[model samples]
Target: MARRGTLALGRHLARRRLLQLGVLTAAAASLTTEAWSSTSTTAAPRFSEYPFSLGVASGDPAPDGMVLWTRLAPEPLAEDGLGGMPNRPVPVQFEVAEDDNFRRVVRRGTVVARPELAHSVHVELHGLRPGREYFYRFRVGRVESPVGRTRTLPPTGAPVGMLTLAFASCQRWSEGFYTAYRHMAEEDVDLVFHLGDYIYEDPINPTSNARQQTVPDYFQVEAITLPRYRTQYALYKMDPDLQAAHAAHPWVVTIDDHDVDDSWAADVPKENSPTPTREEWLARRAAAFQAFYEHQPVRLVSKPSGPDMQLYRRFAYGDLAEFSVLDTRQFRSDQACGDGRVIGCEDRLDPTRTMLGEEQERWLLDGLARSRAQWNVLAQQVFFCQRDFEEGPEQRFGMDEWSGYEPARARVIEGFRRTSNPVVLTGDVHVHAAAEVKSDFNDPTSETLAVEFATTSISSGGDGADVTPATLIRLKENPHLKFENQQRGYAVCTVTRRSWRTDFKILPYVVTPGAPISVRASYVTEAGRPGLQEA
Candidate 1:
């Protein structure tokens, strides 16, 4: 059940006054009218006030357990504002049941939501039966969260019957509603993977969305301060559909460029203009990461320290599937500029350039070599296909993707070939695509290493400004490319022991609020066959 209410500012002010008198704290004097203005504006609902403002969610499902999360906000924005709510810790109880009614409760436990953690609660449940479905919900005071369904992974080496998962990315708040998330919520999936650009870099200009406000610094623009970032995440989390999806299944998420800054590399700034100094940039990065952790259903292992967080990790669904989630942004050479086109930038082709960094690369390769799962799913951001913009030489576009780092791309492909994996799940081109990853695309007879399935954005922009028929012509010049659709929506993958099918779900239009969704295309790759075919 969803909680509803309004917070009166006068009541909060009175409470603050009493607390100040009782403690005789001089700091309480700083809680002036101006400080409370934002909180008092209209009694805006916050995660703490609603207890599920960021919505109920679960993630990182293992064979025996999954992580459940929610923030308890009894008063989202107190008199001091900042959405900090009460300073005291609150007790939150989570319930897991075999049925939606929750009458047959199988698991129940209490976890403390502390102020130090912004009143956020993360309860990791373990020792559950394998390959079983369960429904869960959190409760605090009189409030009950939306019921979410989650499942544990099957036993290792077990011949699992089937598995279904959805992949999506690039959800610009200003573009439109997350109809794709709504569709996914209604889906009976085992898991969900958000492959980055969960939030856009640019601020939501008023023109983009009638409800948006114009702000400066588009990429690092919207979420400058901690409060702003929290508000932004809260705004996105308020989407009922996205909430429903989070409630429906355990999600695996990884951040890409937009989450921090657009096309940001290891220590390099996006705009190249000398505005915020390096120290200021680092501080901003730290703030962004803290906000990200507060909003997402990630483990404490992903907690931010200053401006860095260890985000690359793996999750297994028994022998049926194993996901190698990657972090492409935190450790990569700066984007090549100066050559006019986004891709022709000379530094991109440098062999020393890396996307996953050396340590993570070795970890990935080793994991692939050691895994015995039937499907070795490389759940990651950006396309793994060699995206070249030329019929021959002297033609190219942006080098931010795998196309920019040829050596790294080749190493990944060669690793796949050596390991003989089944498929690679990808997102972040803001377009639907399918490709046959080969060890050597220049050699038509080269062995296909693994199949690549890339989903379009949830709602970014229509085909983007750069993608055109001319661009497609240039893209086709690369032999490994198989299919492409510059559209919006998500990719749903249905996996069996011998084959994996993909349904590329596309929305009518991202610009249109509440657009209808449809299955625009479908493809499949059979076991041992490392390329996609129309389903």
Candidate 2:
């Protein structure tokens, strides 16, 4: 009976997720938020506390629908886990409009902001026209959230004219201000992809921080408990620039290390330590996952199932491109050779040590084989191509990357070889790099299977110089490498049927709030060509 009951619950949750995809099945031309006024707090003061301090966000866009997200945090930086809302469930109303002023409101719905889920709302609006723009907002009593703009994707297997996409990663609060995100908000782009390290795991060193932003005292320690993780996200989300980027466009995000702990594998804790035990580590991971889901504007599919969330999924932009967003931290083998720069480690040569694991590896390869999109991209964290740090005949590789698992990398390369146009979009290196990914990294003359464009960090490391001496040496050592830059910025991709162009946009200084952003370099790869060319 217990097992049967559990199965029934599982079925219910699965149906709930499926329902999110088609929630706006029957939409009224002009819906009203009047229905929610009954449940709203009537006696509350007019200006007791403004709840929308953390701002509003939306993400995970699909052809039919996208997720609209906002959490009711009356006092955002409260010491306790609660966002200063009462213990009871709050009624939150949402509106979707064709115009920014809400003059042409199309969809309106009321959803309960439950206490268990941190008084947040994830309104998945479906049944809308494909490739269309929409504005959304949330209302709780008299307070209203800022209106956010978002757009849906083109229909499946359909061709798009052109796509302006930007990707970035690694935003450490203490390192610098979020000037890159501020710049990104002003760009004319359809969507954004944050490929991980969205929030650093370590606490902010306030004394050393140049930016005068106030990080709450609660987040001064590394996040471990549920409250700590939630607090960390709240503090980061309070930044106006980060909120601006979220409000401007829908984001597709995945987390690397720092969201939970540093360099955490499937169930292994940071630093390869087994002190916490598997069960304890999973519990901690569950808290982190729940906190992540609560804050971000992600789809219901990636919602936490205990410690595990289904983050590795595919997003299609008509027939022009297909983004196979992967989760490298989950289901990956531990770093080989003591987890550092190792020279010729035979342990890395073991084919059995999987990076994407058996399930995700099979899913990725099968998806690549069946995809009809012109450009098939691996939107994921970590470096896809091998990076040998030391300049010598005895090659050295970063143990944390795909280089540590050669056979798995070879499998991915072979799969890419069979595709139409394979491109890898990577982050977590904290520096801009472009490379020709060969089927076999041991032999550069071997067939080039894919081209990789790695974006630099957003504010993880402080302001960076254009080119360091070490970068020059590494570029010389790796002959197949095309470009390298040590600058804080993002990579913008302009995609068409004929070619894909990537511009490495850089910020000279991030230690201050208003730094000038410029294009450091630009590269393009023509159709049928797997290597990069200077634009």
TM-score of each candidate structure, all chains considered together: 0.84, 0.91
State residue 17's C-alpha deviation in candidate 2, in Å.
34
Distance from true position, residue 5, model 2, in Å? Answer: 57
**lDDT for model 1, on a 0 to 1 scale?**
0.71
Kindly list the per-residue Cα lDDT of model 1 for residues 124-192, writing each as its tens digit: 888888877777766655455655667778876777757888988988887766777866766656789
The Cα error of candidate 1 at residue 403, in Å, is 1.6
Superposed model 2: Cα runs more than 4 Å off: 1-48, 272-275
Q: Mind giving the per-residue lDDT tens digits that candidate 2 earns over 1-535?
A: 4864574464344323222222221112123344333554563333345677677788899998899999888777777777787878777778887766566788888888887888888988899889877777777765567667788999998867677799999988888888888778766677899999988767776455768766666566777778877777887887777877787778999989778888778888877443268888898889889989999989889899999998998999999999999999889998888667899799999999989999999999999999989999999998888777887787888888888888898899889867889999999989998899876666778888789999999988789888888898778777677898988999899998989999999998998879899999899998888788899
lDDT of each: 0.71, 0.81
Name the top TM-score candidate: 2
